[model samples]
Target: MRGIVLFFCSLSLVACQDPAPPPVEGTVKYTNAQWWLDGDFAAGERCAQDGLLVACPAEPSLTIDLEGGFVIPGLAEAHNHNIDNNFGFTRMNPEYLKRGIYYVKNPNSVASDYQYVEEDIARPQTIDAIFSMGGVTIAGGHPEKLYVEFLSQMPAYMGRDFDSLNSDAFHLIATEADIAPTLDLLQEQGAQFVKTYLLFSEEFERRRDDEAFYGAKGLSPALHLALTQAAQARGLRVSAHVETAADFAAAVASGVDEINHLPGYFVRDVATTEEAEAKYLIPEDMANLAAEKNIAVVTTTIISTNFYQDNPEQLEMVKAMQVRNITALKEAGVFLAIGSDNYMSTAAAEAQHLVDIGALEAHEVLDFWIRSARRVIFPARKIDCLQPGCEASFVAVSEDPRLALPLPETITYRLKQGYELN
Candidate 1:
């Protein structure tokens, strides 16, 4: 099954779960549509078959006049977590759909925790949530530090043991021996993708002996390659979390399907340290290699906000390095996907941050957020455009979102699979 579309009201209907089925045959017309076309807005008429776009039919039926509404493809969150907890889905999931974000990727959520919220995801009323179940990391990996920091900031879980949370969220693999077994376990847990941690992999060996660096260390190069190869052999998409430029290169060398963020985006300590700054700047050759291999890099630069809170100067330096990295990737022609891996926010924030940093203008960010993000989340699906053979899904707003700065806070309407979501 592809996903939940509204109930069939006419000639043909596909079952809810079929991802690729024979076309459904009801046509709906959207007129006076000021929609994104050829990288810019163009006034046009659009048509849809039930749950799919007929895009340019000669005689489309069931016309609905937009009366000056602006339409764009639904926005997507290519990376996010902390949306699958028992108490969080109800509180957080709707915010995506309400914001017209139709797809979300939880790259490293706990499988056991997913059982608590899976019922609400991937349904018609909910955003299409894809989960990696858990991530593959070393004995003590980066996310442990993230969890500690999260709890420290919240103060609610200050002294409590969160070992089980760590256990469920990560599959620890220290050697080649752990690769096959971990893949099997991930498949058993119904992981949508395979996530691996390459956090500062170049320093992993040295850090292994240091307790202070426990949560900062990740898979060694050999083990990282082994795990990624095994997962790819099983036809799984491998998304890697990387820190420094070395980590990015290692993840690339492992032939991972996606890199979760640019190398220097979240690094705060590098701005002042000349040697450290050099270490995080991505090389042109490496970016070119990633582009040649067709590896997608998700932009989670908004994560920089979580650091350098009191130092604007350091933050600017970090952002300057981030921009250099983004420019490198762009020049190398690497496919960039917008995502907010920041636990406290959404991809919308990431898109806005991209604009605020001058990495991209408002129109470019809006287009990328609406058009590029979904395909990154589901490369095999036809959901990127309002073109023929695409899914009949789109978000409409009262005015052009490109004309504004913070993106639209209100969505006029939503139509998914020929069904009115609003």
Candidate 2:
């Protein structure tokens, strides 16, 4: 009987032991902190990187004491334009790095672009960015008159002429004929993505001939659809900028990959009027359609709220509309990203705005700012996670943000591509 029992036990042990050695798990002294893997709290978790990551490494060659700090993937800005002017390089890079923002998507940068400042950005110590060199808009659309004409006088844009700016900074697509050439120019300039303007799309034709509407109106409905399709065919993702709910609906119907700004942020044409604000409310059908097509959206609410600051009543009204639009989109399961779209600001500001307005729970907003937003900026890369195969770039905080988000000043460490950055 003893011999039979020993034989059975030996067989069982052999069956369990033949596979392989388990990956080493990391140990931490602090029970209060947890390593965030993508969006989950992972305790006693270890990761390794050889360019890409290997979770729970068999033997990690590197070890840096976290000193009980909490960790999260680096943040991103989905609708930034910090590359729009030559001077932006000197100011934006350090600011973005300090904020733990590792990825920036410039929806519409001016011509000289990243090539002009490769030294500052291409380094592992600096943040990475993708450029959609210029955006396609109507002849006198939103940015054409403002970015090309008036701003050209500024020291940052001194010698750039209106015609050259229109050609290289922002295209003036007066008709369908302009679509192919605009896309061609963008590709030639090495654009990673494409941006199309759709300001008050429902009123495009009506606003076209009105001199008063110049610089306010955007692409026609037909042309908007055509441009999106053409850009996609050329292997570029399209991000549409919209104003009214009608414009939002038009963007969704046009089958664009992303919507740059949430509608109802800024009231165009007739400001402060409830009738005008009503046009800002997104319809359930439009939201549903956007979800069905897997279109992502970036929230650029706070900056637009400045347009109504003088009138508290209208500000509240706009907030109410934003809440409704956000609720509708969330219910439809659309992927929402964090973006300031205000060159002067970063994702942190936008995240705070969402929290202030109760647009999302604090934790959910933090996830968007740190995890989801990075993926939105660069959909193909292995980013925004500490999981196996993810690139090992992360930000370590001294406090658990879920309980209370500490100020940026309190951040203990910021890492990029496995190297600790000051």
lDDT of 2 by residue, 1-422 (tens): 00111111221111111211232244111123467865566665545554445654455554566777788777887777755544565567777777788888888877665577666664566778878887888878877777656656655566778777877778888767878988888888888888888888788778988888878889988889989998899889898988888888889889998898777777656754567657887778889999999998888877666566587887877777777788889899888888887656677788878878888877877776775545567777777676667776777788776655535886787666655575
TM-score of each: 0.86, 0.88
lDDT of 1 by residue, 1-422 (tens): 00001101121222232222333356778888787675677788788876777756677656788877778887888888747565456655655666778888888876776877878777655677788987888776766665544533433234534566555667887778878888888899899889888877777778876888867778888888988899989989899988899999998899998998888766634435576578888999999999999898898887776667797877888788888888888889887788887654678888878878878777767766775555567777777687778888888888668866334465777777666776
The candidate maximizing lDDT is 1
Where in model 1 is the C-alpha error above 4 Å?
1-26, 55-61, 145-167, 268-273, 403-406
**C-alpha RMSD of each candidate structure in angstroms:** 7.9, 15.3
Estimate every model's Cα lDDT from 0 to 1: 0.74, 0.72
For residue 13, what is the lDDT in candidate 1? 26
In model 2, the runs with Cα more than 4 Å from the true position are 1-33, 55-59, 271-273
User: How many angstroms is residue 82 displaced in model 2 relative to the true structure, after the best TM-score fit?
Assistant: 2.3
Report the error of model 1 at residue 54, Å.
2.7
